[model samples]
Target: AKTSGGFAPFSHTVTSVTHHKGSSTVRALSMISSQSTSAEISWGIPTGSEGRKLRYIISYKCVNQLACSPGCQDAVEGRLTQENTRMTLSPLLPFTQYLVTVTPEDGLPSEIYVGTSEAVPTEIPSLSFRSPDRTNTSLTVYWEPTIVCSS
Candidate 1:
């Protein structure tokens, strides 16, 4: 305290502090089950950014297709929380390669490549007798279905 003659002047100084959190990122993504027309996937929760809730959006695209129409580019969205990080993507093309993306609300997205299982043929051709065309060493049989890899 300073006094001028008989009076004193008082003053105070205040300091401000701020805290910044670290950036977050996706940890891992694994395939739970992948079928001909549907797929289930799960991922690990990210770290470093605490107390901040994030939403996860899942999307996929076919590797062979030119467009994202059939691969759920914008259709499948997963709002997964910290504990729940699993989702199922369906109505996909069979026997096709897909690039799956898991985008978090805080940081950059993580990607994984997955392939669907082959579909079974719906049509079955009847067996025909061709004994006259069989050779001494081998026999020839023919059964045809046009949709080999329709997707």
Candidate 2:
């Protein structure tokens, strides 16, 4: 139907719709270890929008069943830029599983994207000492691998 202003009226009927909207993608993710403190995470920014605003949110938890949560603990928002898209999460427990998300301000749906990193093991590798003889010396070491899963 045509409107009084000579424009086609908006309709809910089934019709062919073509949209040329752009999307955002995560480029890189990494975690930095600190001394007796929380680990730091640095996330790469998504590229596509020329000058649109962007917001970021991060969530994390321990690997233990009692400590891990379904949703994120902290929510952070900020404007999108070419240089400042990366952020750091601090004060987090050592050796814990963390889930990070990045959302951008675009007209397209599914703004939130999530990524996860395995928890760093808190315990150090066990080692044993052995001596062959008084004149000859020998050493032995043992270690374990960190376990991580992807969904």
For residues 73-151, write the lDDT of model 2, one tens digit per residue: 3332233233455455555443334444444434222223222334544545443344324434654444554332211
Per-residue accuracy of model 1 over 1-151 as CA lDDT, tens digit each:
6576765676787899875543455787888999887788888767865565667777787675312345433332233333357887777766667788887765678888877787764545655554335788987786543423343
RMSD of 2: 12.1
Predict model 1's lDDT versus the native.
0.66
Candidate 2 least-lDDT 10 residues: 107-116
Candidate 2 displacement at residue 92 in angstroms? 1.6
By summed lDDT, the worst window of 10 consecutive residues in model 1 runs over 74-83
**Pairs with backbone N, CA or C atoms under 3 Å apart (clashes), candidate 2:** 54-80
lDDT of each: 0.66, 0.43
Q: Compute the lDDT of residue 5 as modeled in candidate 2.
A: 72
lDDT of model 1, residue 24: 57
Question: Which candidate leads in TM-score?
Answer: 1
lDDT of 1 at 69: 44
